[model samples]
Target: MNKWRNLAILTAGVTMLAACTNNPYTGESEAGKSGIYGGIGAVTGAVIGAATSSKKDRGKGALIGAAVGGAAGGGYGYYVDKQEAQLRQRLVGTGVQVQRNGDQLTLIMPGNITFATNSSDISSSFYPTLNSLVTVFKEFDKSGINIVGHTDSTGSLALNQNLSNARAQSVASYLSSNGVAGNRISAYGAGPNQPIASNATEQGRAQNRRVEITLQQMQ
Candidate 1:
């Protein structure tokens, strides 16, 4: 009877938490997403707590787990949210696109703005933009940075792959030099294999030739 009552209470708590998906006052979707993490954590923690605790203390343990897990999950969401806001503010008019998908943030740097034609060297004009990124990255030091390079399908596979790798390395080196932790960064080259746009037209090819930097929670 006690076990059943505890389960019922947990279920009702999770349901109420899920109902907060949309913030009534701010109307921000992010609040709702954070709530979802809290809900999931609460459920998992409750299960573990009930399983581990003595039968007599099962209810208390479940409740404690639910509170701790919910706070941890929701705290992660809030951390990412604050970082995204700072990124958007810092990257304004910088030709870099700040994108958010859940707790991850990606910055798409176009080839024309980031590098020279068919060259691995970064364009001089893009330095200021990178400096701004350095500031934000240092502030949000808990995230891992992934730098990926891409190219159009106009070149031989080997050449494109090599060039992409070189570009990624250059970006990684720059970030490392600017005080972002080296261990937290990884660079990869997708070359023409991961073309985001078609290679059939000049515009498409141009779009495909770019670098993407993705930041994700370290843990």
Candidate 2:
């Protein structure tokens, strides 16, 4: 299934590139086509990390994708299924939680394992685990990834936002340096605005202080 999806992407990209060889590119100029393909690339990106996202957020991601008319041709779900399976297999016993929704997958790394108290620095203990994950990502290059930072309400709103942003940047930077293309991965900080637990309790706060990385299916 991966081979098929990879082939499809390669074929489309090659065809688009070959179009430049034709004479009289007035109606099909490189500039126009490049813009369209770039839009499709955006769709490819948004499709990642949106499956487990909130409905509103997922909708926004889809809008970014649909506006460019980018799609993975057909059988996109199957391609994603294979990739998700591979990811789950690789992440076994890594202290990372893998969640799936439709053809998208999210990697939830709790703050306990991902970072220190009020720090954005990724722990050295987490390096080996991330290396394993990056090995899979390098193989499955078609998917787009989004890294989101979340925090509990223990700090000021401004501080929480900054912390969240920095944490997200840390993860995204790590992934980029490890092999994920910079263009296909994005980072966003939700701060305290999008908490999954009550801020009144230690347990809830622990759960809220986490990072989520979503991978969209290839298109």
Candidate 3:
């Protein structure tokens, strides 16, 4: 009986590993990570269930555990996929670049479109774009919003950091005022430390001086 149990556990481990490797859901992307996690959860749950159940009912317990674990692990990935689709549809031609990395979604608002030169105040013309974002954020309350302010390397480090911080706060405050829960939002300033482009040219500087809002799943 012990030998059979050991064989069953080994079989489950091998099967899950294989499934994860070949699974369409698994990959280096966020969606793929979700699949790998789901596979791992399934394997872990199956092992636990089988070990805890009577010898005669081990298989049934394992199956139930696998089902539950897989569902739990994949739920967030599904949620992110839907949210991404909605954001892409809403942000069309709005000058907000929607980026997906792993399980997070980032909306990159160019400095030119969101604010005036060296100012933290949001431009009046960007209100509608922000309002659209607020709508989706409210609908998907399960995610946390991280507003990060960034700047070019033209300014002194202190000045750049302060400006970035203020800008991040401005955006965070706007989102909060527009009805996104304050508790679900955080603001930070990255200054010129994390530039997406070389700040040697005007165009590169323009890209660097921007605001990024990233959506992350809440536990």
Candidate 4:
């Protein structure tokens, strides 16, 4: 909820290019280049998420926020290439949804896999995706990973907020556990306030309940 407008504006139209290597957070490999959008997005999202989250949740929030921000920034100028196409095929087979806006690569997850109604336990099924992400990160030369958590707008505002935070933390924990470093990853929860679909309907609610993973260059 913090500086979304300003961050989005500053990230618009920015482009970046870099090499891929092992992420400090995950120790897994990554691909794709880094960019201005990714760097700024990471910074803005981390700062804002840290400021708004409870003290207990701030570390996870910063990790997720930075990743998503970096993804958004790197994504703005990304282009699909042979490697990305191959990555897409691999992700699709593993139940990891992939979306592309230009050069940016967005990975979408069903809430069921990333969280359990206010709980932050990472599903076993999610590990393959995480491993794949690490591979992608190592393959590319980017320095950011965007991890964003979302929820359906059904519960009280406070409950949803905590749920979102927990979800983000869960994903961050998984990445860190596997090999990701705290410096390269950022996490955050949008609660129910940043719904991408209508929460009034089950289909829309499902759409709204998700976590987005973006891989791009850091600005």
Candidate 5:
């Protein structure tokens, strides 16, 4: 399955490159459609250029970078899966739902689990879950993780966005203090922009308030 996904991504990259004729802004036309893996010439050019940092070898860097980036992305995905499996048990009682899709892991935390009305602080009851999550972060390899805070449409858009952002930052800070690298994590507050359910009802409002943790590629 992993192999197939990689192949599919590669094919898409190729097709995308092929369809591009020129960069409108730069007025530069790429020499090859499949910029990274189409041939040995492209590879050689990319490598030499990247290694030497010279115009003659620009192609080499491009080729090497592409190959490295793709492999790294795939390898990181595999690693995330392994880590998620190990952390799944620890996360079970956190009032948070975990969803895994291929190389991605999403941790959905209900508002009641983490904060008070229109606030960003992680509630006392949330300590166990937050602490457990931090422990998991400490054990896992460092990677780019996004902490996204969301809210139901209960207030002004500006207020919601700020609160959401603050919540995400709080979560990020907790993890960072617990051993996760600060630089590897990003906080985002998308107040009411993305809700799992409508805010028309109490249940839906509860559903809309959440924190989303997205594990990105490792450095």
Candidate 6:
């Protein structure tokens, strides 16, 4: 959708929201504020997500993509647009899931591809993927990275916690060694405390054991 059209929709939503500040149902101030903001947010989000989406799917993904990109109402939208495109192109077939939220980008690397079973040492096979990522980071130096590691609930919490931290550091170290700036990256380990999926099944457990490289646009 054109920016002008999007702006028109946003303006209408905000105006309507402002005009109905009092909730009719509960007689409370700012009635249905959440729904109003959600509507406007969805409009603005299209600006970021629509570009990367396929022409046919643009309409469906724009609201989500823009919301995820946290699009500011300016040229920063374009900045995120370019970065998302570059990531999609560079990380193709790498078994990494790239997700965008507003101005943030996250690269989800599953344990099966990122590390050996219960090990934090850098896997030699993963080097090329990291290299590809480093290349992009160099090209897009205005982004700060966060490497977060997570583990399934198979081992003791203490051990899993340590392993998670080790995995994060290991990835960060590898990226640093390959020319990505240390100052641009922060590392954290969540261990089993932050599971994206249930640990009751192997599939869920596998999904939980992962590393996430998140990028935030620098100010």
lDDT against the true structure, each candidate: 0.85, 0.72, 0.83, 0.68, 0.70, 0.77
Which candidate achieves the best lDDT against the true structure? 1
lDDT of 5 by residue, 12-54 (tens): 5643453344432357874422232333333333344355555
Model 5's alpha-carbon lDDT is 0.70
TM-score of 5: 0.64
Ranking by TM-score: 1, 3, 6, 2, 5, 4
Candidate 1 steric clashes: 0
TM-scores for all predictions: 0.76, 0.65, 0.74, 0.60, 0.64, 0.67
Worst 10 residues of 4 by lDDT: 10-19
lDDT of 3 by residue, 106-217 (tens): 9999999998998998999999999999999999999999999999999699999999999999999998998999999999999999999999999999999999999998
Q: After superposition, how far is residue 8 of candidate 2 from its true place, in Å?
A: 29
Q: Give the TM-score of candidate 1.
A: 0.76
In candidate 5, position 165 carries an lDDT of 94
In candidate 1, the residue pairs with backbone N, CA or C atoms under 3 Å apart (3 or more residues apart, or in different chains) clash, namely: none
Model 3 spans with C-alpha error above 4 angstroms? 1-31, 44-65
- lDDT of candidate 2 over 124-153, digit per residue (tens): 999988888788888888889889999999
- What lDDT does candidate 6 reach at residue 16? 52
**Regions of candidate 2 where Cα sits further than 4 Å from its true position:** 1-74
The candidate that wins on TM-score is 1
What C-alpha lDDT, on a 0 to 100 scale, does residue 159 get in candidate 3? Answer: 96
Cα error, residue 86 of model 3, in Å, equals 2.3
Candidate 2 clashes between residue pairs 3 or more apart in a chain or in different chains? 48-216
